[model samples]
Target chain A: MITIFGKPLLLLYGQLTLGLINGAFYALLSLGLAVIFGLLNIINFAHGALFMLGGFVAWALLEYLDIGYWPALVLAPLIVGVFGVVMEKTLINRLYKLDHLYGLLLTFGCALIIEGLARNEFGSSGVPYPIPDELRGPLDLGFMMLPAYRAWVVVAAAGVCLATWLVIEKTRIGSTLRAATENAPLVQAFGVNVPRLITLTYGAGVALAAFAGVLAAPIYSVNPNMGANFIITVFAVVVIGGMGSILGSIVTGFGLGILEGLTKVYYPQASATVVFMVMVIVLLARPAGLFGKA
Target chain B: MPMSRRALLATAAATALPVRPARAEKPTLKIGVLTDLSGPYKDLAGPGAVDAARMAVEESGLAAKGINIEVLSANHQNKADVGASVAREWYDRDGVDIILEVANSGVALAVAGVTKEKNKVYINSGAATSDLTGAQCNANTIHWVYDTYMLAHSTGAAMVKTGGDSWFLIVADYAFGHALQRDSTDFVQKAGGTVLGAVRYPFPSTTDFSSFLVQGQASGAKVLGLASAGTDVINLIKQAHEFGIKMRIAGLLIFLTDVHSLGLEVSQGLTLTESFYWDLNADTRRFADKFARRQPGRRPTMVHAGVYSSGLHYLKTVGDMGLAQARADGAATVARMKATPTSDDCFGPGSIRADGRKLCPAYLFEVKKPSESKGPWDYYKLLATTPADEAFRPLSASACPLVKA
Candidate 1:
C-alpha cells in the first residue's frame, strides 16, 4: 500500500471514497430541494419523508409484488412522484399564496404524519434489503478493496446529478422553466401553462428524492426515521449551497460529505456536527451561499 | 385557538357525570409497562414485555385475594423526555402504582428520576448501563435483568481468554454505549489485552458503518468491539460481514431479537452474555413454552424474562400486603420486594440487593451455526455461566448513597 504523510494511502483512499458516496446522496437530495425552491419559492420540508416513502415503496414492490431492484428503481420514483402530485394538488397548492412559513409548517406536518405511520407499521428496527447479487462482493482495486455496491452508488448518484443539471441548464423546456421562475405572468401570456408547469416541477423535484431513496434502500436498512436523520444535514447542505441554485446545492453537498469523511479519519468525534459547522461558516462568509446569485 | 362554547359545556357535563364506587376498600394496583413500543428496543421489551407482565399477574393468583391488578403500557419512542413526561402523567393523573420495562438506558434514567419524584416504583429490564444501580440509584427504582458491568465482565473476559485480544471499539454515542465501552475496556485491559482505538458514531441516525469498519480494520486490532444494541448491532454486523472483515467481533450488548434480525448466516459464531435465555434450562424452557403461546414464533429475550421475574415478585409483594397499603408508599413496597427473594420459572431464583439491583447469574451464549439449527428460534448454545456474585459490580464500588457504609 502507498504511504502518504506516515499513513497508509489505502486508508485515506477508502475514507475519501466513502465520503464521496455520502456526498452523492446529499447532492441528489439537495439538488431536488433547490429545484423545488427555485420555482415554488417554498421549502419542501417533507423532502426527506418523500425520500423515505420512495425506499418503502421499493421495499414493498420487492416484498409484495416480487418486483426486483431494476423494476423498483424505475417504478418507485414514479409512484412517489404521483404521491407528490396529489400532495401538491390537495394541501400544498392552498399554501402557496400564504406566507412561506405556512408551506414549511404544512410540509413538516406531512413529514411527521408519514414518519409516524411508517413507525406504527414497521417499528423502529430497520428491515434489511439485501444488496443485489451482482453487486454482492468486493471489487479488488489493487491498493484497496471497495465493495461493488458502494462503488455503484457513487457512480450512479454522480450520473443522476450530472443528468439533472444538464436537463435544467440546457434545452428549451429548461429555458422556459428559468423564464417562468423570473416572471410567471410573462411565461403565462406566452401560453406556457405556468400552473401546470409548477405542479410538474414540484412533482419532478420530489421524484428526485424518491429516486435517491431507491438507491439507498440496499445500502441502508429501510426504516421510517431514515429520512429524518438525513434531512437535517441536507437542510444544512442546502443552506450552505443556498436554496435557489441547483448546481450550488450539488457541489456543496458532495464537498461537505468529503469534508465529513476527512473529519472522521482525523477527528472522529466531530463527524456528525461537521456539516453544520461548515454551514455556519458558509452563512457567515457568503450570506447568499457559494454559487447563489445574491 | 379558544375552546368553543360547545366544548366547554361538554367538558363541564363530563366532569359532572362521573362518580365510581369507593376505591379505598378495593384499590387497584396499576402496573405501567413504559417501554419502547415502536423504537429500536421494541421487539426486546415492547408487546412481549407487556405479555410477560400480564402472565405474571395471571399466574400470581392475585385475583383470588381481591387485589385488583391493572396493567397499562405506552411507547416511550426511546426518547428520555418523552419517557419522563409519560411517567409523570402515569403517576399524577392515571394513578399507575409502578412503571416497568423501560428499555433504552437514557429513557430509563430519565424516567427513574420522575418515578422517584412521584413516589412510584420502576423496574428496569432493558437498559444496560450499571449506573442505574450505581450513581443513579434511588429507592423507587430496581434494576432487574442485566447491566453493562455484567455483560462486559462475562463477554470481554471470555473473548480475551479465547485469544481475541487487541481491541478496536465502535461505540454508539450515548450513555449506555459509553458505559459499555468503558466497562468492557477495563475488562479487556484486566485480561492483559490492549485497546488500539475507538470510534463513536451518532446514535440512532447512523445507518452506514462501512467507513467505521474501515477504521476498525486499519486499527489492526484482533477483535472489534461493538458497544451498541438493537438495529445498530444488526447493521454493524451485516456491514462488517459484507466487508469480509475476519476480526473477531465482540458484541457488548445484544439480544436474541438482534440475532434473529441478522439471521444465523451473519450472526453465527457471535458470543454474547445474557442473564436469561429461553432454552438455557428446564425452568426457562417451561416459561418460554407458555410465552411462545402468546407471541407465537419468537422466543423470550432476557429482558422479557426479567419483566416476568420482576413482575411476579412485585405482585407477590403487593398481594401479601393490601394494595391500598402498598399504593400509599412506593419506597416501603420496594423495601418489601427487596426483603423477599426473586424466584420465577424464567430467572430461576435470585435476590434483590440493597442498592435495588437484582443479583442473577449471566450465561455466555454463542450463536448456533446455520447447520446446527434443529428448528425455529434455536439460536444459542451455552458456553459458560458467570456466578451471580462475580457477574455484577461489588457493593463497595457502588457510588449509590443508599449503600450504607
Candidate 2:
C-alpha cells in the first residue's frame, strides 16, 4: 500500500532485486576489463567480441559436443582463454611499447573480424540457449517472482568477482603482477617471469569475460552482436568505477546497474542514457573515477 | 553465387510476362535502395531488401524496354542523419530517380523529409511509423508494406478477442515503439480490454528485460504486449520463457526473421501479423523461391516483399509517364502510381491511396510448434487473412493533409 515518489513500494523492491541480477553481469564483465587494463596496460578493445565468442563457444560446445551448461561454463572460458593467450603471444605482445591507441586500434580491428566471422557463421537473429534445468523456474520471493537463473547469476558472478579481487589484491602472485605493471623491467630483474605473467593476465582477463558470457548465454539471446550491445556500457561502467581499479569496477558495476534499473522504473525514456549521464558527472567530479588512484 | 540465383530467377521469369510500360521514362532510371545494411535490422531489411528491389527492377521488364534501370544500394547503419545525407546525395548527386527500402523508422522518417525537399520518390518498406501516412505524409513519399496501425489492430485485436482482457505493454523507448504502443492501446481498449500499465526501456541497449518482465507478472495483466521489435522482442520472449511467467506474450510487429531467431520452442503460440509471408500462396512461393536463391538459406520478410512490389509499381509508373516527366516531378509520378492498381508477384493486385499509402491484405499467423514445422522457415501457421479492403486503416481515419474531411 505504501508509495515511493508516486510509485508502489512493491515495484521498487522488485526492480531493485532485478537490478542486482543485471548488476551481476556488469560486475562480472567490468571486473575482467579492470584486470586486463590494470595489469597489462592494453586497452583490449576486442574484449566485447571475445565476450561474444564466449557465448558462441558455449553454444557451440552444447550444439556440437553435447556439452551442457555445467561443463561448457568451464570449457568455453578455457578455450577462449587459450585463444587470448595465443593472441597475446603473437599479436598483442608486439604492441607493449607503442602508444595505448595502437593497442586499442588493434583490438578494435580484432573485434570487427571476430564479430564478422561469427555473423557469417551464425546469422544475427541469434540462437536460443535453454536455461539449465536446475535454474529454470522462478522463486516466489513474496513481492515478485525471481527467476532462479537470475539469482544464480548474481551469486556466481559475485563469487567469481570476490575470488578475482582476492587473487589480484591479496595474494603474493597478484602483488608481483601489480609490481610488474608499475615497472616491468624492475619486476623482471627480481626474476619473476614478467612476460609470462602479462600473457597469463590477459588470458585470465579474457577468461573472466568468457565466463560472464557463459553466465549471460542463458539470459540474453545468444548471438554475435550480443556482446557488442553491452561492451560500450561495460566500458562506461569500468570508467565510472575507476579504470584499472579492480574494486572500483566491481563496486561501480553493481551500483550503476541498480541506478539504471531505478531509471527504468522512474524515467524509462532516459534509462539508456542514465549510465552515460552518471559517467559524465562522475568524471567531472573525480577524473580518476570513483575508486581509481590519482 | 549471384549467377546461380540470377539463373534461378531468369529460368522462372522466362515463362511470365512483365507489365510492359508503353514507353521509356528516361534513358537511365537509377533507383537507390537505402536500408540498415549492418545493424540489428540487417537480417530483416538490409541486403535482402536491396535484392528485393533488384528483383523488382528485373521483373518490371524495364530492361527489355531499352530503359536502363539501375538499382543502387547503401547501408544507412540505422542513423537518421546518415540516411538523410545519403538521400540528398543519391537524389542530388547520383541522379537517382527514386529511393526504396529506407528501413529504420527513425532513418526512414528522416529520409522522408529529405525526399520531400528534393522532390524525389521514396517508397518505404522498412519503417513502421504510421505517422508517415498520418502527420508526416507527403506527395514525394509512399508508405509501403505495413504500418504500426495495422500491426496493432491485427495483433492487439486478435489477442483481445482470445480473452486477453487485461494488457501490460513493455515498450522500447522510441518513436516507433511509442506509436505501436499507442495504436495497440487503442485496439485493446476498443475491443473491451483494459490496459494495466506499461514500461518503456531504453532501446538497442537494455537487452536484459527480466526487470520489466517481473513488473509485468506482478501487474497481473493477462497479456504482455511487446511493442518492441527485432532483438528486443526476442530477448523478452526468451527471458520470459526462462522465468516461466505464464502471461500470454504477444509480439506486435514480429518479422519471420525474429521468429527464426527465437525458434519455435520459445516463440510458439504467439499470434502476430504481417503484410507478406514467403509461404502465403503460390504467387509468393514462386517469387520467394527466386528471392531465397538470391539471399541463400533466407526467406524474404514483408519488408523485402514490399520493396519488390513497390519497386515494380514505381518503375511501371515511370515507364508510363516517361523519364523526363517522372524525374522532373515526384508528386506527378506518385499520383500516377496511385492512379494505377498494383499487380505484382508479391502482394498480387492492390491499390495505392491518395495519402501515398499502399493497401494490401494483411495476414495473422501463429508461430508453429517445433513439431508442426516441416522444415526451415516453416514457422508460421496462418490463423486468418484479412481481405485487402479491410486489412489497412480506412481512408476516413487518415490524418494526412491530402485526405479531405
Candidate 3:
C-alpha cells in the first residue's frame, strides 16, 4: 500500500527488478567491451555480432548436435572465443598499428557481413531457442512473479563481471596484461609474450559477449538483428562508463538499467532511448566518463 | 491478328529502342512491388511479397491475352520517405504502372499519395492500417487482403465473447499499431468488455517487453491485447510465457511468419485472424506449394497471400478492360475493379468497394499446440469465419471521400 512519488512501491520494486535484469546484460556486455578497449585500444563493434554468433552457435549445437542449454553455456562461448582468436590473428591484428578508427570501421563491417550472412542462412524472422527446463517457471518475489531464467541471468552475469573485475584488478596475469597494454614493446622486451596476451585478451572479451548471447538465446528470439538491436546500447554503456573503466561500466550498466526500467513504468515510449539520453548528459558533464581517469 | 503484329512491332522496337504505344494492339503494364525487404517487418512481407506478385503475373493468363508484365521490386526499408521516392522513380522513369505491397502502414500511405499524384495504381496487401480505406482512402489505392478493422473485430470481439472481458492493450507506437489498438478497443467495448489500461511501446526497437508484460499483469486484466505485428508480437508472447503471466494474450495482427518464428510450444493456444491460410483449401495448398518452390522451406503469410490475390485481381481487371485502358487511367481502372466481383485461388471470391476496401471473409484461427501440429509450418487451426460483408467496416460508416456522404 506504500507509495513513492504517487506511484505504488510495489510497482517501483517490480520495474526496478526487471531493470536490473536488463542491467545484468548491459554490465556483462560492456564489461567485455571495457576489457578489450582497455587492453587493445580497439572499439569492438563486432561484439554484438559475436554475441549473436554465440546464440546462433548454441542454437546450431542443439539443432545439430542434440546438445542442450547447460552444455551450450560453456561450448558456445568457447566456440565464439576461438573465432575471436582466429579473427585477431588474420584480420584484426593488422589494424593495431593504424588509428583506432580503422579498427572500428573493420569491426563494423564485420558485424554487417555477419548479420547479412545470418539473415540469408536463417531468414529474417529467426528461429526459436527454448528456455532451459530448470529455469522455465516464475518465482514469486512478493512484488512480482520474476521469471527464474531472468533471475539466473542477473546472478550469472554479476558473478562473471565480478570474476572479470577480480582478474583485471587483483591477479598476477591481470597485472601482466595491464603492463602489456601500457607498453607492449617493453613487456615484449621483458619476455612477457605481449602479442599473445593481447590476442588472448581480445578472445576473452569476445567470449564474454558470446556467453551473454547464449544467456539471451532462450529469452529473446535468436534473430540476426538481435545483436544489432543491443550493440548500440552496449556501446553507449561502454562510453558512459568510461571507455575502459571496468567497475565504472559495471555500475553504470546496472544504474542505467534501473533508470530505463523506471522510464518503462512512467513513460513507456521513451524506455528504449533513455539510456542514450543519459549517455549524452554524462558525456557533456564528464568527458572522460564517470569513472575514467581524466 | 492485331496482337501478333503488335508483338512483332514490339520485338522490332526492343531491338532498336524502347517504344511507347498510344493504343491497344496488346496492352503492356509494368508492376513494382515496394515492401520491407530488410527491417523489422521483413519476415512478414519482404522478398516473398515480390515473389507472390510475380506468381500472380505468371498465372494471370494475361500473356495469352496479349499483355506484357514486367515486375520490378525494391526494399522500402519500412520508411515512408524511402517508399515515396522509390514509388515516384518507378512511376516516372521505369514506367511502372502499378505498385503493390507497400508493407509498413506509414510507407503504404506515403506511396498512396505518390500513386495518386502520378495517377498510377497501387494495390496494397501488406500494410494493416484501416485509414487506407477510411479517412485517407484514395482512388489509386485498393487496400487488398486485410486491415486492422477486420482483424480487430474478428479477434477482439471473439475474445470478449469467450470471457476475456477486460483488456490491457500493449501497442506498438506507430500508425499501424495505433489503428489496430483503436479498432480493437472499439470492438472490445461494443462486445461489453472493459479496458483496464493501455501502454504504447516504441516500435522497431523495443525488443524487451517484460516491463510492459508485468504492467499488464499489475492491471489484473483478463486479456492483454497486442496491437503490434511481426517479431514484436512474437517476442512479447515468448516473454509472457517465460513470466508465466496469468493473463490471456489477444494478438490482433499476427502473421503466419510471426507464429513460425515463435514455434508451436510458445505460441500454442494464441488466437488471431487472417484472410488467407496456406492450408485453407486445396487451391490455397496448391498456391502455397508453388510459392514454397520459389522460396524453399517457407510458406507465405496472409500478407503474401494477399499480394497474390490483389495482383491476380488487378491482372483480371487489366485483361477485362484491355491493358492500355487500365494503364492510362488509375481511377478508371480502380472503378472497373470495384465494378467486377473478383475470384482468385487464394481469396476465393471477393470484391473491392468504392472506398478501395477489399471485401473477403476473415478466419479466426488458434495456433496449434506442439502435439497437435502435424509438421513444421502446420501452425493454425480455424475456429470461426466472419462472413465478407460483416467482417469489415460497413459502407454506411465509411469516412472515405469516394463514399458519398
Best by DockQ: 3
Q: Write the per-residue lDDT of candidate 3 for residues A107-187, one digit (tens) a residue.
A: 999999999889878878788999999987889998888889999999999999999999999999999998988888898
**Residue-wise lDDT of candidate 2 within A1-294, one digit each (tens)?**
999998798889988988887788899999999999998888888999999999999999998989999999999999999999999999999998999999999999999999988876777778878888888777888887788888999999999999999998899999999899999999899898999999999999999999999999988988889889989999999999998999999998898889988887888778778899999999999999999998
TM-score of 3: 0.95
Report how far residue B216 has shifted in candidate 2, in Å.
Answer: 1.4
Candidate 1 segments whose C-alpha is farther than 4 A from its true place: A1-6, B1-25, B281-299, B374-376
Clashing pairs in 1: none
DockQ of candidate 3? 0.65
In Å, residue B146's CA in model 3 sits off its true spot by 0.9
Q: For all the predictions, what are the DockQ values?
A: 0.57, 0.60, 0.65
TM-score of chain B of each: 0.93, 0.92, 0.92
TM-scores, all candidates, are: 0.93, 0.92, 0.95
lDDT of 1 by residue, B73-117 (tens): 998988889999999999999999998889888889999899899
iRMS values for every prediction = 1.7, 1.5, 1.1
Quote the true-contact fraction of every model: 0.45, 0.76, 0.73
Instruction: Answer with 2 or 3, whichever has the higher TM-score.
Output: 3
How many Å off is the CA of B25 in candidate 1? 5.6
Cα shift from native, residue B182, model 1 (Å): 1.3
- Looking at model 2 chain B, which ten-residue stretch has the lowest summed lDDT? B17-26
- Please give, for residues B169-230, the per-residue lDDT of candidate 2 as tens digits: 99988888899889999999999999999988887788888778877888899999999988
